[model samples]
Target: EGLRKAKSRLMEPLMQVDITTPEEYMGDILGDINGRRGMVGDLGERGNIKTISAQVPLANMFQYVSTLRSMSKGRANYSMKLANYDFVPPNVEEELKKGFVLETEED
Candidate 1:
């Protein structure tokens, strides 16, 4: 009852993602990150490899190893850690709520 009266928002975990890939694969990697609702933070370099830093939602990172391998032909590598929690966008929240089911026990 209290929850109904108060304002609330769905929150999701965001991850700080750091990727290292060859120059040739930079565009593909960046596109993929954008598709996952990621925000690119920095662009840097280490020797011949290019480095990308971005923040992406944890939900979109499942099975990312295979995707990265295919995109970069096993050349790119990435690591991620919990960055923070943020409120879900209205559209995404509505979609999530559609699949949610509530169960109650009979008294």
Candidate 2:
């Protein structure tokens, strides 16, 4: 029981993200980040490039590079650094467990 409890308390990964794109693509980029459960942090620029800073859960960011590239027509560039590991949200944990059960049942 103690082992199960400890396993359930595992940490989740979080990332610090910085995305740069042309001005024309700002709206689409912002909308995409919001849809991915990301929180907008700061907005800045390096010369003509507009940059968005956000922190997003690592799980939710899978395939993000492909999606971002498609959306930007290869014009956007982004980077992420693993910022910390934190507790998984209850809902996310439940969903992950459900997925595991579903996979087992399928097999």
Candidate 3:
């Protein structure tokens, strides 16, 4: 197909995320964010609470509310909005392409 002959890449949305949590949970929160492929940005504190800012892919944020609640013992809060789109990692792109091919072949 013409599409296959052309150069194309898969992209995914990235989000700007800010999280506020008790100081005690800072380490756990940071670890979790990193594990989710988030790039940590700013860190700040207010009283016993800490604030963390990061950019994370939207795909990694599904059901994040539940994860945050459990990790922070219901004490952390976060907000995220779409920041931009970036190319998917090569491995993920390959998997997506394989799935797409399977779906098209079944039709």
Each model's number of backbone clashes? 0, 0, 0
Note the Cα lDDT for every prediction shown. Answer: 0.91, 0.88, 0.92
Candidate 3, poorest ten consecutive residues by summed lDDT: 1-10
RMSD to truth, every model: 2.7, 2.6, 1.3
Better of 1 and 2 by TM-score: 1
TM-score of 1: 0.89
**Strongest candidate by lDDT:** 3
Model 3 pairs in collision: none
Q: Write the per-residue lDDT of candidate 1 for residues 13-38, one digit (tens) a residue.
A: 99999999999999999999999999
Candidate 3 per-residue lDDT over residues 51-79, each given as its tens digit: 99999999999999999999988999999
Off by more than 4 A, model 2: 1-8, 101-107
Residue-level error in angstroms, candidate 1, position 68:
0.3
